[model samples]
Target: MRLFIEVPVWLGDTIMASVAVENVMTHFKGAEVVVFGSKVATEVYKAHPSVSSVEVDESKQSKNRWQWLYQKTKTLGEFDLAVSFRRQWSTRFLLWCVNARQKARYRRLDKASIHQVKRYNDFAAHVLGVALPLGDLVLPFAPHSFARPTLGLNPGATYGSAKRWYPEEFAKVAIALSSTHDIVIFGGPSEQDIALEIETLLHEAHVTNVQNLAGKTTIAQLCAYIGGLAWFITNDSGPLHVSAAYKVNTVAIFGPTMNTETHGWHNPNERIVKLDLPCQPCMKRVCPLGHHACMRGVKAKDVLDKIALLA
Candidate 1:
């Protein structure tokens, strides 16, 4: 049997959806899975045992995007089943266009506080007519080994600046941890500036054992490197989820987003540091009010304390 799966666009969401993907693959045992999604999001399944191929969905770049997607999806031969983790209208159209014996797409449950991992698992369970147990975030990569003990710092939150903690605070944590571990700063192209700021702060503090890897790593490299970390200090972002997949001890600093819904899935080593302000979880790209007290109230000490307890 063959399966067609369209994952979510965001890297973090794709990681969270891995549990459902795994469940479906297991149920259809030995099915050759073909994944479709953004280039970055598709990387999560590249190393999966059941996935035969991955297609990057570049529909947005086409002149007639929907038509392009329909044409693109039609080229692939018939599949036994197709599943989509996205709820967009285009996804509905894509499922309709594809030549598949059966089709399933994720539908939001009435429960307000369902974690994303469970929601995806529930979607897969509903489609397969069984109760599926949630699994750990799956990123099948070779374990990375570093010469010295390494601590990772990720200060970028792709959702928006409102979710990001201060770079100076990240730098402070790096400096404190530097005495015992080498610092590895992680970020994507858009986060290079934030990574550089942290690097500068670390250097100014006379910490030399640091590598600024912002914008230099592919998604695979990011996974491998994060998988090797002794500890991770990051805002709620893609890398944090990556760390969780590898079971890396992680300290996730939450700002505008709700931790209850999006926190790392099935990772006992993960610790969340956030302020319980009444105005928290505004869920805005930018802070609505001028003051970002939701993030500002969270101090570097708060993160360090969490790490201390986790250690």
Candidate 2:
């Protein structure tokens, strides 16, 4: 069978959707899957064993987006089944334009609370007309081996400052763990400055076994490097989910976002570190109230304590 899957646009959502995609792949054994999404999101499936190809969407950049999308969908020919994990009108339009014998698109559930992974899985099960157990977040990159244990610090939260913990706190965690484990800082292009600040703090403390890898890695390289970590300390960001996909022992710092809804799905090794603040779950791009106490209240010691337990 040939399957066309439209993954979510964000890096984290794309990873979470892997659970559903894996289930669909298992149900239709030996199905050749083709994924379409943003460049960053599509990268998650580039190394997937079940995926035949990944097409990065460029319609957003085109002068005539609908025309571009129509042309793009036309060139793909036909698929046995097409599924979209997104609820946007554009995705619905794509589902209509694509030539598939069967098609499915996500519909929001009325449940009070549901993890993103479970929601995606429920959608897949609904499409398949049967229930199945949830699957792991799938990334097929081989883990890199290090001579000494390595600790990864991800201080970048693309959502906003509301979701980010302090870089100083992250550096403190790195300094404490640096005695036994090599420290590697991870971030995207927009987060390079924050990663650099953490690196600077570590250097000021005379920590030499540290690598600042912000803005230096492709999504694939990030997966390979993160797959090898003995431990990962991160904000609720894309890399946090990436670490979960690899089953890396992780300390996920949460602030403005709701952990219950977006925390690592079915990863026993992952631990969430968050303060139960009234202002939490605000889900704002920036903190509504001037003080970002939701994030500020969480100390490096809190994260380190969780890592200690995981260790």
Which residue pairs in model 1 clash with each other? none
- TM-scores for all candidates: the values are 0.98, 0.97
Q: Choose the strongest candidate by TM-score.
A: 1
Candidate 1 Cα lDDT to native: 0.91
Model 2 C-alpha lDDT versus the unseen true structure: 0.90
Candidate 2 residue-wise lDDT, 1-311, digit = tens:
88999999989998888888889888998887889999999888888778899999999999998898999999898999999999999998999999999999997654878888999989999999999788788887788887899999998888788888999999999999899999999999999999999999999999999999999999989988998999999888888888888888999998889899888777789999988887778999799998999888889899888988988
In candidate 1 the C-alpha lDDT for residue 26 amounts to: 91
Tens digits of per-residue lDDT, candidate 1, 1-311, equal 99999999998999999998889999999888899999999988888888899999999999998998889888889999999999999899999999999999889864788788998898889899999988799998876899988999999988899998999999988899899999999999999999999999999999999999999998999999999999999888888888889889999998788898888888899999988888888999899996999888888899889999988
Backbone clash count, each prediction separately: 0, 0
